[model samples]
Target: MKRLEGRVAVVTGGASGIGFASVERLAAEGARVVITDLNEATGKAAVQRMADAGHAEAVDLVCGDVADEAHVADAMDRAIDRWGRLDIAFLNAGVGGAFGSLLETAVEDWDQTFAYLTRSVFLGIKHAGKRMGEGGSIIATASIAGLGGGAGSHGYSAAKAAVISLTRTAAMELGPRRIRVNAIAPGVISTPLAHRGKESNLEALCARQPWPDTGQPADIAAALAFLASDDARFVTGETVTVDGGLRARSSDVLGDNSMLLAGRTGMNRGSTGLKSGFRNTDR
Candidate 1:
């Protein structure tokens, strides 16, 4: 039998990239999943694709903004209603957040950044905790940028740091209920959210990592699967770094004030037309 044979999962931002890879991984492990994304078309297409790849009955799609209180709450509720139980909740929906220099960042950009990157995680934990049973696992997507400087923009880094904090605190509160909360701090993954179609630059920048290979969405998905399964039953409130040594060394795109562009501040572009998620925003 598969590791997660009888489990049920909900993955936000499940339309593509890391999110889609995670959804596929979880489903392959035998978990029935409800996919949530801002774009209904993209979400449905993804469900169809996953179904075609086998496990046709194991995946479903739900569309909503992750930051909205109503949408987030309902997403969790619907998963339980459909699957009869919720075992894993991957609160991975996010945008690159407000990019560019801190000084030039707009107030609206900062607010929206938190809305997508931070608030959504909080809502996922809140609703999922309420609905999850013992042995449940909750995972959030954090960033290496949250751990240190230069890698991400001002607002994006701040928001991810908030996510890491939220995970620790939530894990403490939910431990008694047997629900585990944790965050993954990914570095330089080769996703639509990372390269933004700069395939040339993508390979060049990502391969600069100490590991030499570009971090892929499947790599993160594998870690996420472990956390969601019984394999990580004893782990909670930890921020697992999956950056391929990106954090151990200096970053070229990190805002060092040397290559910092002035007056060009906005949310980075993304695959969903949400905050552009290609977070290497110095360009």
Candidate 2:
């Protein structure tokens, strides 16, 4: 639709999953896309694939860690150098740490999670906002866990919560300049990060989803494209949830009339037919 024609976009973690999908969508919509990833080979190959697919001059790949200031700066530099101006920044680079409770989680692990998920957002907003000045959009990839208490990987939940707050503050600060900032909280997307489920009980996980099927990276990517485009020009400081009705479902589920009757009599602790809820797999 050429909604972003002549625009320059920087998508962090663009080598795979939602980030990669967003890069492809942006390029398809006529934006000059610069994909940044820590994996040099995959990043270059992704750009090449896009080029081969007829987006030859619209894509570039930069390799660097999103948490590094110099790397983030270099990515921004590359986007501006190639396209002359920056219009969109998708700070989607993040990692999901091992599942563990807060008390059992190591301090270093917490630090690393915050570094990539939270501090990296800070760096992205700082540099991208500075370069954009006005008429730009910054979207962060948060998770639904940010909205509530988490059971596994406490650090990730906390970092995502911080990302939401960061988005709000950045929006307030940049609104005067007409630069919008927002976040997307995806539920359970089937991405490389979610592949950890294959090693576990996949059946049980599938049963827990409100929808029959799991979400795809492209779902989140499409949301990103809309947010980055002028379609969301008036949207800012918001977190749009992309869950498959999982978050809105009721937690209580009765197995049979016997269980319901038992619950009325206080015979069970409202747990006779309960099962372990699905874990947060968004990264």
Candidate 3:
């Protein structure tokens, strides 16, 4: 659609998964894209694929770690040097934490999680916002876990929650400069990260989706492209959920007996306060 024509975008972790998909989408929409990834070889290959597809001038690759401020700053500087300006920045680099409860999680794991997920986003916003003068957009890849309590991994949930809060505050602060900041909360997307586990678990997770299927990297890339385009000029301080309706259904489910008892005791009152034992059962 050429929605991002003449614009310049920097995507961290752009060698794989959602970040790579975003790079492809932005390039297709006529934006000059610079990819920053920790994997040097894959990052170059990703750019080469784009160049081979006749987008040679529209793509650039930078090898770096998002968790490092110097690397991020250099990446941004490279984009500006090439394209002369930066219009969009997608802070999509993140690492899955070790699966464990809060008490079982180690301090180093928590530090690494915050470094890659939360602190990386912070640095992206700080440096990208400075390079982009006015009318720029910053989109971060937050997860559906950011919206509520998570299961299994405490570090991932906490970091994602911090990302959401950071996005909102940045939106408010950067609004004065016409810089929009937003986040996308994706659910159960089939990517390299998810496939790193057992195939059975991945299948089971996908099967439980409310919709007919799970999400893909492109699904999130589409949402991010929209947020980056001028069409979303008025969008800010918002989080768009692209989870295929999985999260919309309330997670609270009870047995028939419990439902019957609550109904009989007037505990399941319709959005109205009611006394049930020692608790308010209006929900």
| Model number with the top lDDT | 1
Ordered from best to worst lDDT, the candidate numbers read 1, 3, 2
- lDDT value for candidate 2? 0.77
Query: Model 1: residues >4 Å from true position, as ranges?
Result: 250-259, 274-283
Model 3 TM-score is 0.86
lDDT of 2 by residue, 119-160 (tens): 999999999988996689999999977877531246667889
**Cα-based TM-score, every candidate:** 0.93, 0.85, 0.86
Better TM-score candidate (2, 3): 3
lDDT of 3 at 264: 22
Error of 3 at 110 (Å): 0.6
Error of 2 at 272 (Å): 42
lDDT of 1 by residue, 1-283 (tens): 9999989999999999999999999988999999999988889889889978986789877899998999988888878888899889999988876767666677888998899899999999998998886669999999998898777778888999999999999999999998999999998888887877776656655765788788899999999999998889999999999988877775554445322454455676477765342233445
List model 3 lDDT by residue over 50-111, tens digit each.
88889899988888778899999999999999989999999998776533434444576668
Give residue 159's lDDT in candidate 3 (0 to 100). 86
Q: In order, how many clashes per candidate?
A: 5, 0, 0
